[model samples]
Target chain A: MTMARRLRTKDLSAGYDSRVILKDISLEVPAGRITAIVGGNASGKSTLLRTLARILKPKGGSVLLDDNVIHDMPSNAVARIMGLLPQSPIAPEGITVADLVGRGRHPHHGLFSRWNAADDRAVTDALTATGIAGLAERDLDTLSGGQRQRAWIAMALAQQTDLLLLDEPTTFLDVAHQIDVLDLLVDMNLSRRTTVVMVLHDLNLAVRYADHLIAVAQGGIHCQGTPADVLTEATVKTVFGLDCRIVTDPVSGTSTMVPIGRHKSGSVGQEAQSRK
Target chain B: MTLIIDTQAAAPASHARNRGTRRAVIVLNMLGLCLVGLIALTLSCGQGCLPPAHVLAALTGADAGGADFVVNDLRLPRALMSLVVGLCFGLGGAAFQVMLRNPLASPDIIGISAGAGAAAVFAIVVLSLEGWAVSAVAVSAGLGIATLIWGLSSGRGAAGARLILVGIGVSAMLNSVTSYLLLDAPAWDRAEAMRWLTGSMNGAQLVQVWPVVAALAVFGGLLAVSARDLDLLRLGDDAARALGVRSDATRFRVTLAAVGLVAFATSAAGPVAFVAFLSGPIAARLTRGGRFILPAAGLIGAILVLAGDYAGQFMLPARLPVGVVTGAIGAPFLLLLIVKANRNGGTL
Candidate 1:
């Protein structure tokens, strides 16, 4: 399934109030492929995601979604076509998982419209897709970290939008859960062809999971392309200030970075395996 | 991913079951029954030892002139005022809590009632006004307090704490203004202003009570129309917006409804302190409902004011104002809330 639509920005500048956080940054997120935006702590990765999500309006950039400027698009319309999972989005206390996922259907369900079979089907499908069908009745707070994140994703999925954006979805999870969530995203991309854009801290995971890469640094796009093309040693050093050995992951056949630290022996190359 | 495979507890139809509503209905019915008893007691025992039988007889249009006059003309209106005002305060406050997603968002404590009282006081002492014009003053004052609180709390998306704090500030300012007006004015108007300052149900007649009843109808309808949206609002803004609810607009309407509800009740009976605040929490606690239960909370509010009024004047040698009774009962409850909120880090 080749769903190759594209979201592009032309000279977009945005920030909080008057402070310019993202400079005249321009990039394209090709649909039907995961775009991992990589940068250090203040590289404006999250801001770019929010701007693309239309939660924060850009000052001067034009975000064109299939020729319709997303800035000019009604937020609900944008929200309907594209879903966003903001980092650390707080759920209302005591709301159940099914209720949380049910919220994703809100964009589809107009006021005064009765809940129908399709809504139920979509909610069930989202839960099943994320493998939370059994825990669908559980309170959101009771779920473990990874399970909760998947629930949040299931909420985004239940929107049934063609596009999905996630910010640091793996921030608090353990490595095993991180793999579980990334695996789900990969499966979602393959099966549904949902355009996925995310800010990922793990460099190797970004390369492994994302088909396209966007490296943001100093309020601008530093590099963007296929993961292997963008995840060069020079880009890594400039963006993350880490000397690393780049290798193709034997299993996934993607660019994987082994970060080089000073703790290794003088002759020993920096093959810092984070978690095997 | 500790999926644990628990099909029993997923977040779907299990939440939509009728338990919350059932609890609310039971509590409201009991409260309603007690209110009926309190009203009967109020009509029967006040300065006249008229038997419950006589009041019931007069209420049924039997021909006893003295009993008819007291039951139909005097105490009935007072009791009805307590009922209506309490409903206004309770339901209105509950609606506010659901709207703002905060327990501290009640009309009585958050300066809306203070705004009405302040405006009414200004109309009386500063402008030397009288009669139904105070209702208009009340509407505007309550609206003003709401806007000020909204303006102050805009940064935090009008979090409960911010609204409560800003409301307290405005209420304090208005209260001081009221005190100044009362203290500086002539002795002739002094006694009259005092009743307006403290919430009162004394000297209330049906004609005077109509404004509150009417206000409750309009405001209460507005809230009911928006009740489902208000219920979704307690789920946080993103979740609410995701649910296709135009949240900010809905919030505005809810605020307007709350202001109208409290302002009219204040105009009719004077800021019957904390009934609005207490009723919502009590209802939520008792019913364990998912979101705002406005009518249920309102029933509790009506019961509190009516029962408090009954216990106050008749239970004592001297007649205590309805507001005094409510304060005496509601203060300790407020203290308990403060302690609970403090222990829970004050978010409730």
Candidate 2:
């Protein structure tokens, strides 16, 4: 796999209609590594990812691909190098998994081109990589949530881009499924040297899975670095507006954030006295 | 899993895709055959009930006595008009439904047909226009109304529902305009306008058939070019864009071509009631929701118009207009679909 592709944003501003959600945010994604953007609800993490993916047009500045303005390039040319899986994508009623995944080859063909052997191989490989090859003939509506998400990921995989961006991929899944998805992403990153960037709601999972972490706050990036450097208590307090303690994760040997709420104080004496 | 298991699992996926492709091909061929049979039956069995040989002789420009005038001048033009007009409605309607991701968003339901109807009525009654001039006015008005509806409903999110609702409102308004025009016209002009408004194959000239045929060629060609891109749009704007489809451009091209098709057909055929609304869903059902439904839908549209015209003229107690018969069939289906959607919590 080519490791020359680089995705970066320079002083970018973007939003819906008139309301700017991300303002002058600048960041570079490390190629062939897993990067995670984490934040509280509506903190522009998704907006930033969408802007980079060119799903949302940047209001000012630019998202650059190998130092070229992404928006200025032909959309199909950019799509050939990068793929994005949105937060919620609709499946047409009664579409089979293989058929849906094959749609990922959209950028590879022109208006009059027929599906070739390469297209078939890409779809097969994607389905196999996502471990949903067995469910290829099944209707998407019949799949479990995890399996459905896997199908969607398989679609992005079929695109065969060097860069993959995902927005809240594990939002509706169980914890086991969340880990399953993250592990799959890591596998892709390691095996294919495919750059993976995702917006994660779970801070600990983001810290655990991502090699680099970016914290977003109030329409701009608050902090960014290695997980250990960026997931400190001060960054969490500022970015999420929540009091939290950062500790070493025993499982992953990475930083983990444990939020401290009004009632769940870890004082043993206070808990005992309240019980008495 | 080993390579053996992987190949085994992969087999069914390819098999399913092949099966779907095969099914679509078979269904389209069947629809084409049915359309041909209907056209043949229509030609051979009207009024005096000429034989196939006589009809064929007339069609081939060999003298078949009095059969020449009836077959060449009358039934052939009407059947040809139905064929082209049906193709236009089916293709245009399915394009709208698929692009909007709603089965109910056909041109007739969305005021495009009403626009053409209102214009034709205005031309016949007020402007005193005749022949091709009336068709030209109707086509222009249909295109104008489509543009207006698209502009009104387009925005950031949930544009499909907004477009459908806006179209319904516009349709109602245009229908009222058509009615009001009819109410004040002279008796002879009123009768002529009413026949046009209700959509009839009566006086379907060979000249009128050519414009719709030309429309089917140009606009249908445009639609064919964008067919794959339009199918991708079914996955929603974000996904389509990520897949490298220029969603806005595809939508624009599709909308323009589809409107051109509906407008031209309406101008020639006078807004054949519900033919546009009914074709897509019927074709979808017949094809079992295949990936490419436009061609099947177009064939179905042709069949419906041809069959409805034949049935209305012959089978009905009174010789009714084609629109009335199709309207009767379509209105009940629309109600059933709405009811089913409502029961499913407002999804179709």
- Chain A structural similarity (TM-score) per candidate? 0.93, 0.95
Candidate 1's error at B31, in angstroms?
Answer: 5.8
Scored by DockQ, the top model is 2
Ten contiguous residues minimizing lDDT sum, candidate 1 chain B: B9-18
Each prediction's RMSD to truth = 4.9, 2.7
Expressed as tens digits, the lDDT of each residue in A1-276 for candidate 1 is: 324557888899977777788888878888788889989998889888888877677888678888788868765677677888878666655656877777787677554786676877788778889998877767787999888999999989988888888999899999999999999999999999999999999988998888899998878888899887998889998999877778888998887887777676244343443421
Query: Model 1: how many Å of interface RMSD?
Result: 4.2
Top of the candidates by TM-score: 2
Candidate 2, B234: how far from true, in Å? 0.6
Candidate 2 residue lDDT tens string, B195-233: 667677888889888878888998999999999888888
Task: Extract clashing residue pairs from model 1.
Answer: A12-A61, A98-B11, A136-B10, A136-B11, A137-B9, A137-B10, A137-B11, A138-B9, A138-B10
Task: State TM-scores per candidate.
Answer: 0.85, 0.95
lDDT of 2 by residue, A124-221 (tens): 88888899988887888899999999999999999999999999999999999999999999989988999999999999999999999999998898
